[model samples]
Target: TQLLEQSPQFLSIQEGENLTVYCNSSSVFSSLQWYRQEPGEGPVLLVTVVTGGEVKKLKRLTFQFGDARKDSSLHITAAQPGDTGLYLCAGIGNTGTASKLTFGTGTRLQVTL
Candidate 1:
């Protein structure tokens, strides 16, 4: 199992700013996923990177996986107030079950106007 670590536990920024969040692990993962959560709701998956050095972009967000499969990053361009939420990264060692995922602590982003 991989243990995930996220950087910048808390972030506060203005609209139109750009930010990057990181997730690192010592162990390799079969797949890694990024998620965003609102105050009162569960996390929603943003993107899943299964291949090493893979990058996936969603609108203004970009997700990248490390070539060694031990790390990942998320970059947001031109932040928006509506993007405020708790971002999470989850590493999966195997595809067996939902219980096998190791989740990062999380990065709380507050984008202000």
Candidate 2:
């Protein structure tokens, strides 16, 4: 079983600011996904990195998978209040019959104007 940990459990920033959130694990993952959850709603998929050293950009957000496949990072440039939410990183592992998803502790981001 792999345990994922996210840094800066809480983050408060102003509009147009930049920030980076990290997800780390001791075990390797076949793939990883990042999600953003708003209050009173389920998380929405943001991006997925399958290959090691892969980087995907969604608008102002950039997602990077570590070369070792054991870590990932989410960088947001010019953050806006719309970006405020609970950010989660989930590691996907295939267990033959099924796929297991292990989610990180989570980082709550609050972007103010």
Candidate 3:
């Protein structure tokens, strides 16, 4: 069974703090993607890495795909109140519908101003 699980289901931090969230699974994935969504809004794609050991960065946010393709991580260098949101990782399965994406449990981050 392929599934993505996120750590620290909840996080509360002051402004300008650094944090990292992990996504792990025992099954391999064709592609791994990260997304962030604000309250009452849909998730917005942040980055997608198809190759193993791939690293992508978006400003203060960094993402890494495991060499085994079974895990991923998101590192935030410095977070602000504007960075507060739900961070999610999605694994695109090799089988099943092409557009199917299995999402992680999600990590709600609160950056206090």
Candidate number of the best lDDT: 2
For model 2, residues 1-113, the per-residue Cα lDDT tens digits are 78999998999999999999999999999999999999899989999899999999999999999999999999999999999999999999755556667999999999999
lDDT of 1 by residue, 1-113 (tens): 45799999999999999999999999889999999999989999999999999999999999999999999999999999999999999988855666466899999999999
Ten-residue region with minimum lDDT total, candidate 1: 93-102
CA shift at 68, candidate 2, in angstroms?
0.7
Q: Give the least accurate 10-residue stretch of model 2, judged by summed lDDT.
A: 92-101
Candidate-wise lDDT, in order: 0.94, 0.95, 0.93
Clashes of each: 0, 0, 0
The best candidate by TM-score is 2
Error of 1 at 107 (Å): 0.2
Which of the predicted structures, 1 or 3, would earn the higher lDDT when compared with the native? Answer: 1
Instruction: Give the TM-score of each candidate.
Output: 0.94, 0.97, 0.95
After superposition, candidate 1 runs with Cα above 4 Å error: 95-99
